[model samples]
Target: MSAALQIGLVLFPKVTQLDFTGPLQVFSSVPGAKVHLIWKRIEPVASDSVLTLTPTTTFADCPQLDVICVPGGFGTDDMVNDAEMLDFLRQQAKAAKYVTSVCTGSLVLGAAGLLKGYRATTHWSAMDMLAPYGATPAKTRVCVDRNRITGGGVTAGIDFALTLVSILVDRPTAEMIQLRLEYNPVPPFNSGSPDTAPPEILALMQERIAPARQRRSEANGRAAARLGGDVAAG
Candidate 1:
């Protein structure tokens, strides 16, 4: 039998539930694909008191991955400042054939020093954080730069994962999965992107990101120190 394409999805406490679950659904729907939840510990982690997931393996116990996926949320804010977590992400991402992130998960990848000189995207509110890692921020919901792929905001994971399937497998396969999921989306609000959003809504999003930006700045600092300040060279 052919080996399954092993996909590792990184999970942590307070992660944005949709960022991981949406992609999980897309990837798991693929034939001969295996999804493994990887975390610092092999236990259930909660997502901001909303959902819980039991990790299939800790980082140390994980198998070699064909793909390494990172999801974003408040947990990512914490991960960006965590030395052990950053190191883990850095190593795993470096070794994986494909590295992907969802939402502000791009921030975590940036913090891990993986996006340097790459084209990437993240939650619109958090796109600025990619600068330090030498990435050009894209406004699109999904971006693929060489081996790295990134998705913007919460619901972008499904699109991102479907894109990966198209790349790694075939467009027909992706279309089949999309059809299976009834993937055509009709949003009630046309404000998914900043350009289409009402000024007040855009302002509110910017305002809400203030604290997160501050925390990301501090976390970037800490991550740099732990890496002996090599991030700037990227």
Candidate 2:
């Protein structure tokens, strides 16, 4: 029998829970799939929300994964500069069939020098940050460029995973999984995106997140410098 498809998602402090959990929920349904929550050590990690997550494996003990995913959140500020985490991702990407990210997780991949010369995407607010890592940022819900797949912002993970399912298994199987999960989304507000949100609301959010964005920018600058890329002050 064929070996089960091994999937690993990196877990870190202050992660945006939905970034990984949404995809986890979808991936769990894939037949013959084995999922692992990876970290530097096996312990409970706090997320941006009230939810806490535990790692199933440590970097040193993790088996080679078929798919390696990074989920983004405020935690990425630390991850971008984490030597061990970057090294682990680099090692895993060498053998992983797919290197992917959700939300700001793409920034972590970029820090590891994995997204160089790739087309990727991240949260709309941080789209401009990808260029320093040699990645061309695409504005979309889910962006797939060759083997690098990225999901934009928080809730886009579900869409990203469904798209990946279609590729990893088959469209029929993906459709079945969607149906089984009743994955129909009907958000009451048409304000999910900056393009759709009221101007004041968009401005307010941008203003509120500016500090985090600046921190992320500074962190990316350091990581990029380590990779011999141009460094820009935040």
Candidate 3:
């Protein structure tokens, strides 16, 4: 029999745990598929301010992977600007069968010169940052540009992962996993996002997230200058 498909999940401090865990659960449901916690080193790292997770592999020790998944959070602002981190992503993604991301993870890919001329999406609040990275920032929750797949916001990771399962294995398998996980979503409030949120709530969210956004935007500018490529958002 063939070896199990190896999937690597990138980890960094301050990353939204849900962005990693949501897709991790769905991917783990598949048969003969392995998921590894990847990071710059082997250690436990905390989420943007929430939970902590231990990484299984580092840049130098990890084996070749079939898929590489990047998750986003405030930490992405850091990763997107790290020359070493982005270079690693570019190398692994170039050889991987698929490269995927959730939330602002697409921004990391862009920094790696992977999203050129590819339509992609990220958290709506962070979409504007994509332009400088040479990607056409899309508004959709899920966007697939060739082998690169990206999702918007933290919750969108679930949907994107199910889609990936369908693409990599089979639709039947994907559906079965979805059923097993009870993937249905129900928001307590009518305002999970800017459009659905009341004006006051939207303003509040923006106010709260602005500092991180500013950092990400600055990192994007630095990355763009380093990469020297055209922005493609279509």
Candidate 4:
């Protein structure tokens, strides 16, 4: 029999719950899949939203996984240079078959030195930050560059995970999962993307996101500096 697919998602403080949870629902439903919510400790971790998620495994105890996923949120800024967290990611990514992230989580992977020379994407507000990591940032909802797949903003995780489902299993499996979730999206508003939103609304949104974007840009610069060599070169 084939071995069960071992998948792990990093659970950190201030994470956007849906970034990983949306994907969690899809991944956990996979047959013979072992999904773990990993953190430094098995504790209740707070998120940007109201929910607090509990971690299933501590970093020290997490088994080598086939996939390592990270989700992004306002909390990601602090984790950019978090030595312990970045070290854990670097270690897991070395042995994992796939290394992935959602939203600003790509910034985390870049911080871990995993996205060097890869094409990736992040939340629209933080997309440019990928450049310093020696990554080619794409302006899309989901980007799959080699084995390093990345999703855009918070809601993009489900789409990214579904894409991953197709890669890990097959199209049939992903289609079935999508059907089960009734995942057909019909967003009530066409303002999801900056290109589609009214100019005034887009400007206001950019204004609100500016501070975070600035912080992220600064953090990405530091991270790329730390990574040096290739990241700087790229």
Hey, what RMSD does candidate 2 come out at? 2.8
In model 3, the clashing pairs are 14-48, 134-231, 134-232, 135-232, 136-232, 136-233
True-vs-predicted CA distance for residue 169, candidate 1, Å: 0.5
Best by lDDT: 2
Best by TM-score: 2
| TM match of model 2 to true structure | 0.96
Work out the TM-score per prediction: 0.92, 0.96, 0.94, 0.95
Worst 10 residues of 3 by lDDT: 225-234
At residue 56, candidate 1 shows an lDDT of 92
lDDT winner between 1 and 4, please give it.
4
lDDT of 4 by residue, 1-234 (tens): 199999999988999999999999999878899999999998899999889999999999999999999999988988888988999999998889999999999999998888888999998888778887878999989999989999999999999999999999999999999999999999999999988999999999989878877887787787778888544477
Q: Give Cα-based local distance difference scores for all models.
A: 0.86, 0.93, 0.88, 0.91
Count of backbone collisions in candidate 2: 0
lDDT of 2 by residue, 60-176 (tens): 999999999999999999999998999999999999999999999999999988999999999998898888888999999999998999999999999999999999999998999
Off by over 4 Å in 4: 229-234
lDDT of 1 by residue, 1-234 (tens): 188999989998899889989999999998999899988887789996667889999889888898999999888768877767777877887678898999988878877778878999998777766776668999898999999999999999999999999998999999999999999999999998888999999899889878877886777666545544664454
lDDT of 2 at 36: 96
Which candidate, 1 or 4, has the higher TM-score? 4
